[model samples]
Structures are given as structure tokens and as C-alpha cells.
Target: MSDDLKEFESDFATLAKLAVQQSEEDVRLLLGRLVRKYRQRHPELAEQLNLSLKSIQTRSGSGALRRESLSEQAPGAGVPLDRDSRLELLKEFDDRGGMSVPLLPSGLLRQVESIIQERQARETLLARGLAPTRSAILVGPPGLGKTMSARWIASRLGKPLWVLDLTTVMSSMLGKTGANLRAALDYAKRHSAILLLDEIDSIAKRRSDESDIGELKRLVTVILQEVDHWPDTGLLLAATNHPELIDPALWRRFDAELRFSAPDTELTVQAVRRFLGPDTEALGQWIDTIATSLKGRSLSDVERAVTTLRRGHALRHAPDEELVSAMVGADLGMKSKVERLTLAVEMAKAGKHTHQEISRLTGVARDTIRKHAGPSPRRGRGMK
Candidate 1:
């Protein structure tokens, strides 16, 4: 057997032996000490193992360390294994396994690297007398890469990203929501995983507007307290599309605010070139023109316009000018004459009215309207 496997086997044997002789408290104490020793000796291995050490101090019980058992009451029971637990502990030793590392695109790599360095610097500050900042808020419109950056950070830090599952975590049971959140926070703290709270504005909105202010206040209080006392070993990342709508108090908890604004003309062109190739040169110029025309539009808008243009081009086998015109017109807030026709077509497709009804309402051609409607999933379904 390999050295690592031999070592793990030896450790497991020792635990089993101790469990047989020692009291439950003694076994737990012994296990904790062994875990600490292992961590000190092989920090990297310990991290790879993803072992969580929780002290189970309760009334008298069996001293035996139950192997591969699942109990909600057991300390640190809900912590997920780094690998599938179906394989016996001994089998896991033979099976090579490792965590997947996330890859960030070249354009965003430097920014994510800087965030890691900033986190390290904060750790150094905490080593001295100064208190390090505990939280960060990533603000960006949809699909501008906020979530991607957060995932990259977690991977780089060798931490699991515990995405806050509001649906599962939120409970209608009286007083249970708060307790569940607290348990989750405690679990996060124990495991040293990055607690990523995406769409934070949904939960942390301004309390003044809430009809049930008490519940909102309590939830916010728990969040703030957790942020305040979060260990320096892990990072906390929160993201929001609507930063302005978030509570003002929520801003104070975060150490840094990273704003991912819409890409400039140059960046947008680069992104398009990267995603699509040199064949999209004319499309890129059109995009640059569109970007200039719509200064305040988001990256999402640019992407959607490009997707629609590509789809339409493929459907109609159209030339560059026709495709670009269709794309630009379909985009919101554009003043092109074709834009009105595109809007009417979209409204009609959405079940508002038929083409004849649309034409009667807006004085546009039913055939022309049908042309702009593009591929209809509803029509395909109907044909089927």
C-alpha cells in the first residue's frame, strides 16, 4: 500500500482501538488531538481530506467511534464528504480523488488574482494587532461574471463554495428559519468554506419597506453578527445585481465593494472576438456602434443582441447588414425604424395579439411582422 494509505489505515486502527477502551469523552478528546496533530504535520493533506473535527460533549454514551454512520444529531454529521461515501473508508484510500479547480477566463484572471492577494494581505493585518475586514460585496448586472469570479475565488482558496440555498434553508416553521441559518453559519465556520450569498439584496433589502419588519430585522441581525465574528481563515462573498436597493447597513459589513460595470467598447469587442472569432469583425464593429449608441446598456443586453443576431442569421441565411440591422432594432431603446416592427412582433408572439391584430393596432404589415417573429417554439409544438 502507498504511504498515505498506510498512514490513514494506521490512524483509523488507532481510533478504533481507542473507541473500544476509552469513554466517549476520552475518545472524542483523543480524536481531536489526533486531528490537530495530523493537521500540523500535514496541513495540505488535512485540507485535502476535508475532515471536520467537532467535539461531542454530552451525557454518558458508548465510547465507540461509529464508522460511516449518518445521524443528524451526531456532531458535524451533515458535513458532506469530499468524495462519495458509498465506497468503504478503506476503498477510498485506494481510489485517487481530488477537488475540481475552477478556471477563470483570461480577461478576468488578473482581477480574481488581485482579490486573493488582498485576502492574504488582510490575513497578515490580522496577524498583527489590526482587525482584518471580513466581508466583500460583488456588484454587477446579470452575466457580467460576478458569480464566476466568486466561484474562482473559492477554488483558488481551496475552499468549498456553500451557496446559500434560500429555498431549502428558509423554513415556514415557527422560529426555525433563524435556527437553521445559525446552524448553517456554524457549519460553514467549522468547515472553513467560503460562504457565498448570491442575490443578497433579496434577503437583505431595506427593512423599512418590509411588512414583517421583525422577521427581516432578526434575519439581518443574524447575518450581521455572523459577518462580524467570521473567522479570518475563510472568505465571505456576497453578490447583487441591484446594489442600490440593498440596506445601507449591509454596506458597512463588507470590506470591499467590487463593481463590475458594463464592458467598454474595447472590452466588448474583445469579448465578442474571444467568444466568436475573427469572422465576426463586421459584427464587432456593429456592436461597437451599438455600444456607443446605447451608452448605459448592460453587457447582458449586448450578449442577448449578439445571440439574437447569430440565431436570425442562421435562420434566414442573411448577409451581414441585414443581420446587424435586425439585431440592433430588436434591442431595447434603439431608435431604428425596424425596432418598432421587432417590438410589435415580439408582443404578438407573447400572446398579446395576432399579426393582423398587431397590424391593425400599429399599422404594420402582417407578413413583415411574421418575418421578424423568427423561429417560434409554440408553432413547432403545434405542428408536432
Candidate 2:
């Protein structure tokens, strides 16, 4: 290892030793003092160090460490560890194997670093008498890694991330939906965990839209209030493909707004290589072409296209030429709702058929046929 890496390893070893010798409560006190001191002197290090502290707490506890331990610790009155002691403890514990924060790949590491910096700015703002906003809105098309980013944040911060499943929380009965949301939010708050409201626009959509029901409106209101009242110590992230559909109030409440847009040609090429593996050279070229063709498409669409192409190749028992031809045909046009709806209607009438068969009959792209015939029922018909 290089000199810097060797130094880091040594420091981490020392920190681990110190951490292992302390009781869980003692560690919390030590960490609390460390967090306060770090925030005062080197605020940039606070988020990363705080995350490590949380990780140590989680791993050291008998059960899961209560969120209250971090947020509701007795006001002042803990270990007398200062910045140097905390740093030494961190160095000792750096490699002791208890939920060490996963480092992002090199390309993404810079972005993660920027997020840490932004978090420090928010903390500084809060310290200066501004109300600290704990909510973040990660707006992106599907599969651009918005959810992954949220999980990464939780991992980096040594906090458990609770992904709110809309289906579980939404209810048909009056008042039940709001109640469910409140219960979930309270659980998250009490745990001091990261609450990820994935595809939030589905539940917290604009009230003015004709399709929205009164129950949804109440749910949105409750959600907005919860976001407004969120504890500064915890993180709340909401991710959506359709940000325009989100309620205005919710939009304004977020302290940080990040957009995970479609990957450019370079990123798409890298992703194709990452997913398809290096040996598939012809397949990679086909993906490049598809990526070019689907310029404005979401990451989900790119993945779907790749899967369809691979399946088509596999089922045909075809060589590279045939596989390339099939992929090229599918990549001819943009994915369209009308095309999908038409295929779904045709499939309903035709009964179950393979993608190629559906494509032949409906004159639609084979990829489109595959997508529409997925697990979901057709637009107007129930699955039999």
C-alpha cells in the first residue's frame, strides 16, 4: 500500500481497539462528544465521521441501538474525548468489520463526497439560526440510481434505511391511509433511521389533478406536515420519476434537490459493459446503438431493452448476426404507450404468445411486445 493508505490502516486499527474496549453507552457518549467537536472545528468531516460513529453504535449494541441514544442523549455529560481522541478511536476501528460504509465506485465517489459537503452546509445553516430542513427530493427517471443513492446515504451515515412501500401504506378505507403513513413516519423518527419515500409522486401527487381522491389529499397533507416537522438529526429522502406530479408543498420542503438524469452516451456504454460483461463485444456494440437510439429514455428502459435483446437471442438459439438484427429492429423507434397499449390489446385477443409471435402478429417491436406482456395485466383487461 501507499504511505497514505498505510497510515489510514494504522489509525483505523487504533480507533477499533479503543471502540472495542468501551461499553455501548460509553461509545455513544464518546461519539456524541466527537460529533459536537467535529462540527465545531472541521464540519466537513462531521457527516462521514457521524456515520462511522453510528455504525459503531449499531454493531456494538445488544439489540439495535435505540435512535433516542443519539438524538436524546442527556444534555452534555458524557466521555471527555476531544477531537484528537475521537480521531484516534476512528482510526483504530476503521477496519473492524461492522457495517463499514460501502464506498461507491470511483465515478460515483465524487458525487457522494459532494453530498457530504452539502450536508455540512445544511448543518452550518442550521447552526446559524436557520431552521434545518431534513428532507431531500431525488428526482430522476427510473433506474438512474435514485433509490441506490438513498441507500448509499444510509449506509454511509450508519443509519438503517426504511423503504416505504406505497402498497402497504395506501388504503381504500377513509382515514386509514393517513394513519398508516403517520405510524410509519413515527417509527422512522423514533429509530432515527433514514426513511426513503420511493416513487413518492404516486402517493403525494398534486391535489389539483382530477384522478386524485380525497384520501390521497389527506395522506399528502400528513406527509407534508411530517416532512416539515422532521427531526434535524435524521434524514428523509423522497425519490420520484415524475417530480412534476408531486405536491407543491412537499417540493418546497426539501432542503436539497438532486436530479439523477439519464446517463449520457459514455455512462450508458459503461453501464452496458458493467451489466453485460466484457466478453459480449457484439452485444456491447448493439447496446451502444440502442443507447444512441433511446437518447431520452430512462435507465429502466435501457435495462428492459437489453433484457429483451438477450432473451430474444437466447430463445432463437441464434448467432451474433441474428441477435444483432433482432436488437437493431427493436431499437428502431422510441418506446411508445400507444404501441404498448396496442400490443396489450392484441395479446388479450390472441391469448398467450411468445414475444416474436406477438411482434409478427401486431407489427410492433419485439421489445415493446415483451414489455407489455410482462406480469401486469393489459390496460383495460384483468389478468385471467
Candidate 3:
């Protein structure tokens, strides 16, 4: 086919894919790009496309979206903003078909999946004289996938996730912080959007604290009332690293509370495989050792470490065994002497490296590895 025809086919396929995914914003963006691309050779087609684009923009600006589903509207449609700073109080993410399932433990994964299934079958519950879970609080340390899980829930339900930005909601002007928060909450309710209050403890501190100003106390009051009366049509999620700081009253209002912690051994191995991406096959032999060393770390840390390994191997031509050895050696400080010796034995038994190499990597002497795991294989069998 001709170059022009190939370009046209590619653009057509992209538009079809976006439409199927119900990605309105991406469809509009692609259409706008096409209009510019064909303006010279296909002026009439470009003009027609431009007119259709303008009509959609006019509808979006004229409040037609409120009458329709909020998820189908643009990312910025009707988002509340702070009065003094004019910063957006809520950040929008319409993940749709683009989100990845969060890497959570089986128990936590079931809970997250239950939330999604409940939302999907909400009408059936309502007909049976029941109500779906209206709100939940995710309590955990940072980098444990609370925010990502929220996004995944929204994506599975084919809706948009609106996250409350506490920095923007806390206005400089007196009494304005409460108003900003209220406005954002009201907007989310009006659209029935899945709303996430990230780092909720920042404003929902203990109400009895004598040092907290009246405005903060008022903010907590607002959240308490909102959480209690949040409608079944919308799902409200709050995540916090410091659950202790949250008021006791606020905790009671939530329908459920989900707790997150660092990855365990099994989940750590899964995270290593997922983070390894295309390099998983080439480095499969070292994944167990990597996961053993990275156990108890957050998924974000695993991703960073795996990404660094890939970059080193791809750019610097580092051997897989060398990269794995360096990573294990760096993490040896966190392991006890017995744990180090155990890892050394595993490496030695795998026959992928010499006992001396394992000793150096794990701080366990070669004699200890030999005593525990027998003799290492020929050096030619493993990485040179």
C-alpha cells in the first residue's frame, strides 16, 4: 500500500481501539491530531472533523456532561479548585482498559476484587434490600499500592477515579480549606465518581488534639459526616500511612478497613517476576535469589531494583549473574548470618555460580557453602 494509505489505516485502527475501550479523551486527542495531519491533502475531511471536534468541546463546556456519565467526560470537566491558589482540589484518572492489576497478597487481592464485584453488582444488591459498601479506608505504609489499588478498582468498573489532593484542599485563607474540601466532595457525589482521599490523616487528625486549629477540626468534622452519609451510588476510598493520626469517629464511619504491609516471600517472588518484564526469561535463574534478598521490601523498591538491573545489562553489558550477585551483596546487611548462609547454600546448589562467588556475594565463607551444599559444579556450567 501507499504511505498515505498506510497512515490512514493506522489512524483508523487507533480510533477504533480507543472507541472500543471507551477512552473519550484519547479518541478526541487522536482525532485532533488527524485533523491537522490531513489538512493539506484532505482539506474537506479535515474541516468536517474539526467541526465535529468543536461540537464535542462546546457540549463539554456547556454542562452537558453533568447530565451524562462523568467517566465519559474530559479529565478536567467540572473539577473543583481552591479559591486562593486556584489549584485543582481533585486529580482525575480515567484508567479504563489501561490499568494493571495491583500486585497484592492473595488475601488482600480477594478483598480488592470483592470491592470491584460489589460495585458491578450493586443493582442486584439494591433490589434485594441491601446496599453496597459505600466507603473504605486503606491503611498502610507508603509505597504499598494503596493508590494503585484504588485506580485498579475504578478501571475494572469502567469509571474515573478522582483523588483528593490535600495540598490543594488546604487553602491559605481562613475557613477556605473546609469549603474547598466540601466543594470537591460535592462534585464527586454529583457525578457518582469513585473518589480517593489519599493521605487522609493529614486533615483527619484527632479531633481532641489541643494544638490543632479550629479549621482542621472543622475539616475532620466534614469528612466524618460525609463518610457516614456517602451514597451507595458512589464508592469512597481513603488511604493513609498513619492510621493512628485519624480520628476515632472517622474510622467508625467507614464500611470497611483494609490493611497493607510489606510483601512476604511468595508475594516478593511474584513482584520480582512482574518487575523483570521482558528480561524475566533471561534472568529466571536469579529471581529466587533476588526475591530472597528483597523479601520484606515494598513493591516499589523491587521495581526500582529490577529496572536498574535491566538498565545495567542492556546499557553496560553486565552479566546477569554479576547483576544478581551485586544486588544480593548490597542487601546482605538486612539478613541475619543464618539467612545469609541459607542463601549461599541455595546459590551453590543451583550450580549457577562458584562457591567462592556465592561466599563473596552473601558474606558466607566458601567452606560453609561447601559443607552445606556439597561441591559446586564446573565453572563452565555457569556464567563465566
C-alpha lDDT of residue 142 in model 3? 80
* Residue pairs in candidate 3 whose N, alpha carbon or C atoms collide under 3 angstroms: none
Candidate 3 Cα misplacement greater than 4 A, ranges: 1-75, 171-174, 204-211, 333-353, 370-384
Best by TM-score: 3
Runs in model 1 with CA error above 4 Å? Answer: 1-112, 120-133, 165-174, 204-211, 277-295, 312-316, 332-384
Q: Judged by lDDT relative to the true structure, which candidate is superior, 1 or 2?
A: 2
Reference-based TM-score of each model: 0.54, 0.55, 0.75
Q: Which model scores highest in lDDT?
A: 3
User: lDDT ranking from best to worst?
Assistant: 3, 2, 1
Q: What is the C-alpha RMSD of each candidate to the true structure, in Å?
A: 14.4, 15.8, 12.4
> Which 10 successive residues of model 2 have the least lDDT summed?
87-96
| Model 1 C-alpha lDDT per residue in residues 314-342, reported as the tens digit of each score | 67768765565455445534455565575
Q: What is the lDDT of candidate 1?
A: 0.56
Sorting all predicted structures by TM-score, with the top scorer first, yields 3, 2, 1
Off by over 4 Å in 2: 1-113, 117-133, 204-217, 278-287, 310-316, 333-384
